[model samples]
Target: MSKIIFVNLPVSDLNASMAFYEALGFENNPQFTDDTAACMVWSEAIFVMLLTHDKWKTFTNRPISPITTSEVMLCLSCESREIVDELNDTAEENGGTADINPKQDHGFMYNRNLADLDGHVWEMMWMDPAAMTN
Candidate 1:
């Protein structure tokens, strides 16, 4: 089987978290979703597992970080700069915070940061495919 990536994040509220991700355009995979966890599918190969605190604790002994601090930042690539802006705007409309970091535009690439309701950072980006060959 091909390898796939699943980003598991601890969220205070499962339903709210699911809504937040859905707003960013990810579809929920009911095959692996329930009250305690929601399998949000970004693509066939990329999924984000939103787990409630109790469900998350099952996979770790470490304490959950307070909302004031971030343990990691997740980045998603968009087909164009406009899509990045659209997603970021949707995130803000769905109770997320947009622009945690200043926008970065290197001509060939652009990105903006947003914080989910639980304070996890999601960076939306766009890159020119031709730029990678230069």
Candidate 2:
């Protein structure tokens, strides 16, 4: 069986968070969603679990990281540089902060950083397949 990754995030507002991800093309799996938690599928293999503060405590006793601080920055790949830009633009329109870090463009690869409403950062990138062969 192929391995699948589930990234669990603590959210301040479950409904808002779900909407934010939905704006970026993530689909919610109602079978795994409830008042306290939501399952957002980014792809067949990548799933993000958005949990409320109270629900988060059940899995870990660690204090919720402040919105001003970043514990980790998650990265996702786009099909093209244009797609990267579009996703970042959508994020900004949906309450996310876009370009939290300076954009990176290396001819072969391009990237932009966006932070969700709860301050979780996502690095959207695109790489040239032709460049990989050279």
Candidate 3:
């Protein structure tokens, strides 16, 4: 079996976070969901557990970083620039805020950032396979 488990970062609002991710097209896995955490299935092998901060802390002793002071940004890939833009748009529509970084067009790759409810940054990107070839 594949060692497949994506980290579930804590958020203040589980319902809002679930809605936010749902807007981006990920389906909810009822099998792993409860009032405090929702298992969001990105694909067969990839999943995101949107947990309430209080419930999430049961697994760790580390301090939860405020979104404004967070240093790490999570990056996700898209198939095309249009898809990148679409996700960002949907995120905002669902209450996610945009990152300060401007959209980048490297000819082969396009990228942008959006900060979710708890201030976690998520980078949305697209890369052209043809341009990746030498």
Candidate 4:
């Protein structure tokens, strides 16, 4: 068996959040989606569960984090620097805020950060495979 990750996020608006993720290349799994939550798949092993405030509260009593404050930053690796840029751009086009942090670029690696409609931070990055050998 292989391990899989399900990142659960509390969203103010489920539909909007789902759309935002869809623009960033995530596919909604209707099998697990409902009025209160949505299952967004990033890859075969990576999934994001977008839950409404009420649904989120059921899981944890903790208060929801403010959009201005980041509890965590999720990072996604891209095939190339171009793909990283494309995802960032797509996010911005779909109600997300792009370049929340300054862009980072090294000869072998490149990264950019974007914030979703609910202010969840997602870092898009690309690294040269050849550089990994060094």
Query: How far out, in Å, is residue 62 in model 3?
Result: 1.1
TM-score for candidate 3, residues paired by index: 0.92
Report the C-alpha displacement of residue 111, candidate 2, in angstroms: 0.4
lDDT of 2 by residue, 1-134 (tens): 79999999999999999999999999999999999999999999999999999999999989999999998999999999999999999999999999999999988899999999999999999998788645
Q: What overall lDDT goes with each candidate model?
A: 0.92, 0.96, 0.84, 0.94
Q: Which candidate is the best by lDDT?
A: 2
Residues 1-108 of candidate 1 have per-residue lDDT tens digits of 899999999999999999999888899999999989999999889999999999999999999899889879888889999999998899889999999889899888
- After superposition of all CA atoms, the RMSD between model 1 and the true structure is 1.2
Q: Between 1 and 2, whose TM-score is larger?
A: 2
What residue runs in model 3 are displaced by over 4 Å at the alpha carbon? none
Per-residue CA lDDT of model 3 for 3-84, tens digit only, reads 8767688989889898899889889999999998999987777798988878888988898887778777778888888888
Alpha-carbon shift of residue 92 in model 4 (angstroms): 1.1
TM-score per prediction, in order, is 0.95, 0.96, 0.92, 0.96
Worst 10 residues of 2 by lDDT: 125-134
lDDT of 4 by residue, 1-134 (tens): 69999999999999999989988989999999999999999999999999999999999999999999998999989999999999889989999999999999987899999999999999999998687644
Could you give the candidate ranking by lDDT, starting with the highest? Answer: 2, 4, 1, 3
**Consecutive 10-residue window with the lowest summed lDDT within model 4:** 125-134
Using lDDT as the yardstick, the better of models 2 and 3 is 2
In candidate 1, which residue ranges exceed 4 Å CA deviation? 132-134
CA deviation > 4 Å runs, candidate 4:
132-134
